[model samples]
Target chain A: QQQVKQSPQSLIVQKGGISIINCAYENTAFDYFPWYQQFPGKGPALLIAIRPDVSEKKEGRFTISFNKSAKQFSLHIMDSQPGDSATYFCAGWADSWGKLQFGAGTQVVVTP
Target chain B: DVKVTQSSRYLVKRTGEKVFLECVQDMDHENMFWYRQDPGLGLRLIYFSYDVKMKEKGDIPEGYSVSREKKERFSLILESASTNQTSMYLCASSLWAGGGGYEQYFGPGTRLTVT
Candidate 1:
């Protein structure tokens, strides 16, 4: 079973707009929520991450809002730019060294 | 900063052929992982190693095996290549936090095609 579910599959937005991706998990044991960004023909890179202790964490224009009670987390990219257009994936892990469960992925396209 | 490098960007192998994918990391991270990425499936872990010569199976490990002779290098071996095994393989490494709260750095990825 897919422990993590993400939506929508794809998203399109204008430059300067906000791009938001949401993820939910069924395993309460998962404590780490990390977002990865990938360009075509490239590997996924870490964008932002949050722990369950914090309800929200923000870094520059990227923010991760986590809800432990609801078992959900979302990534908000503010001031989206053309360079930011890539596939985004949110993953959760039960332990730091354990296997990770990933979402299907969200393809974000930012048009100028 | 940590850097992960894969041996090949793209490769092609014939069916029933033996295939090997190699990954190397600069940092002395204790954890190394191998994952396969497909169109709909985001990333599925095939195997992971916590230390040298130690390996564990991931979500999908049926047709794959892994080796880690050193802390910085991890290898994935396909006993027999099949068309269905064609996919983008990614290697990742992470410094183990005391608990399960560390981030993993990924390699560029290797695209493999089996005919």
Candidate 2:
């Protein structure tokens, strides 16, 4: 069973439009959440991360909105660009486990 | 900058052959991990090592084993290659900060094709 569940397997958006991907998890022990981005021929890299102490965290055009009680989190990309097109994955981690549980991943495409 | 390098970018092996995928990290991280990425399945952990000669099984460890003889290198071994094992294999390394989640740096994955 997948510990973290992600929605919208794939999405397309126009340039300058907003792109959003959401993920939900059932484990309450998870204290850290991160989003990873991967290009066509490369490994996934850390894009943004959030802790339960804060409701939202943003870096540049990437934002992570987290809901502690709801056990859900979402990533929003502001003013999406064609160059931003890639696969995004949401993951949850607990200090006790020392490993991340990843979602199924969402492929985002931005049309110019 | 943390650099993780995989031995091969692509490999093709026949079924029933033994396969080895090597990974090395330049950051001297204490934690190293191996994961397999497949379409729609995301990345599933196969194994990880926290220190040299010490290892732990991850979510999916079947048909795979790992060796971490040195702090910088982690090797994944397939006892006998199978067609079903064809997929992109990724290696990652992270620092062991006592209480919080540290970022993991991943190598440009090795795509394995078993025919």
Candidate 3:
């Protein structure tokens, strides 16, 4: 069973536009949510993350909006650029669990 | 800075041959994980180790095993590699916390091919 589900497996947006990717989790035990950016031939790297306690967390052009009761979280890239074109994955982890559940991932492409 | 390093960036092995993938972390992390990445499948965990000499099966552990004799090194072994096992393998490390969550640091990944 897939514990975490992501929508829009692929996305295309214009430069300087907003890019959004959404994910939902079934495990209520999850407390921390993180997004990862992966480029070709490289492993996934940490992008942005949010906890259930916060409604939103932003790091520069990247933002994570979280909804605890809904079991949903979304990643938003403001002023998306060509460099932002990469696969995005959302993952969840709980304390002492030691295992992280990942979403299927979204391939985002930003056009010039 | 946290750095996780995989021994090889690419590897090829024949079917029924044993294959070993090595990973090392310089961050002194207590938790380490192995995962395989594939198209449409995202990343699936194969094994994870929380302490030296200890290991646990992740979501997909069939045909795979792990060794963690030391805190900084974790190894994934395929007793007999199969064609289906060909994929990109990633190693990650993180701090162990009983009640708090920590981010994972990932290596560059190894692309393995089984012929």
Top model number, DockQ: 2
For the second chain, the TM-scores of the candidates in order are 0.98, 0.99, 0.98
Model 3 lDDT per residue over A1-112, tens place: 8889998899999999999999999999898899999987777888878889999999999999998888999999999999999999999987656689999999999999
Screening candidate 1 with a backbone cut-off below 3 angstroms (N, C-alpha, C), the clashing residue pairs are: A95-B100, A96-B100
Reference-based lDDT, residue B30, model 1: 95
Q: What is the descending DockQ order?
A: 2, 1, 3
Note each model's CA RMSD in angstroms.
Answer: 1.2, 0.6, 1.1
Tens-digit lDDT string for candidate 3 (B1-115): 9999999999999999999999999999999999999888889999999899999999999999999999999999999999999999999999987876678899999999999
DockQ of each: 0.81, 0.87, 0.76
Total colliding residue pairs, candidate 3 = 0
Residue-pair clashes, model 2: 0
Mind giving the per-residue lDDT tens digits that candidate 1 earns over A15-54?
9999999999999889888999999988898899998999
Give the interface RMSD values of the models in order: 1.0, 0.7, 1.2
Computed on C-alpha atoms, the DockQ of candidate 1 is: 0.81
Off by over 4 Å in 2: none
Docking quality tier of model 2: high
The better-scoring model by TM-score among 2 and 3 is: 2
- What lDDT score goes with residue A76 in model 1? 96
Best by TM-score: 2
